[model samples]
Target: MAKAAVLVASFLFVALTMFCEEATADYEGCCVSYSKYQLPFIRIKGYSIQTPNDYCDIPAVVFHTIKGRHICANPKDTWVEIRIQQLMNKVKKMA
Candidate 1:
């Protein structure tokens, strides 16, 4: 019975992995992981907060780079907070 249960669990894991891979391919904008390196402000053009939604599972700060790359960042990181504050200040000045 134990071996049977293990086999079922293993099968389920493989099935879920396949399903997630297809889902990730279908929806290209979700950030499953964050970049480990810190990006400089000069390279960043803008940023957006990614809230958890259907299909997409994690919360992140998505930074748009000057080279047009989407960088997934950890929102809890200090540098992310500083960048957010800087963007907010710029918006406030514009308004």
Candidate 2:
């Protein structure tokens, strides 16, 4: 009976952990990225054009979606790294 209880508890723990992991955001915050050439082309469905450019680092955000499928790229050409850092800071403060 004790072994069965332990097994059930372990199973419940594992299931709850997995559920929470799935509920969490894929990219909750922003980070400085030097190159975005390798990232898959994600369509910005709901997000507006905050900053537009054709280069490595870009500034963009997910207006609504939380999963990887909704996050989009901004493609800022000049001063991308700096701008992204600033945006990340602002987001941190707001959060």
| Each model's lDDT | 0.78, 0.42
Model 1, residue pairs in steric clash? none
Candidate 2 local Cα displacement, residue 80, angstroms: 20
Alpha carbon deviation, residue 34, candidate 1 (Å): 0.5
lDDT, candidate 1, 6-57, per-residue tens: 9999999999977644211125777877877777887878887788888667
RMSD over all Cα atoms, model 2? 12.8
Best-fitting candidate, measured by lDDT?
1
- Report the number of clashing residue pairs per model: 0, 0
Candidate with top TM-score is 1
Which portions of model 2 miss their true places by more than 4 Å?
Answer: 22-95
RMSD (Cα, Å) of model 1 = 11.2
**In candidate 2, what are the lDDT values of residues 6-91, reduced to their tens digit?**
99999999999776442111333332232333232232123333342444234554232324343334445443344445556766
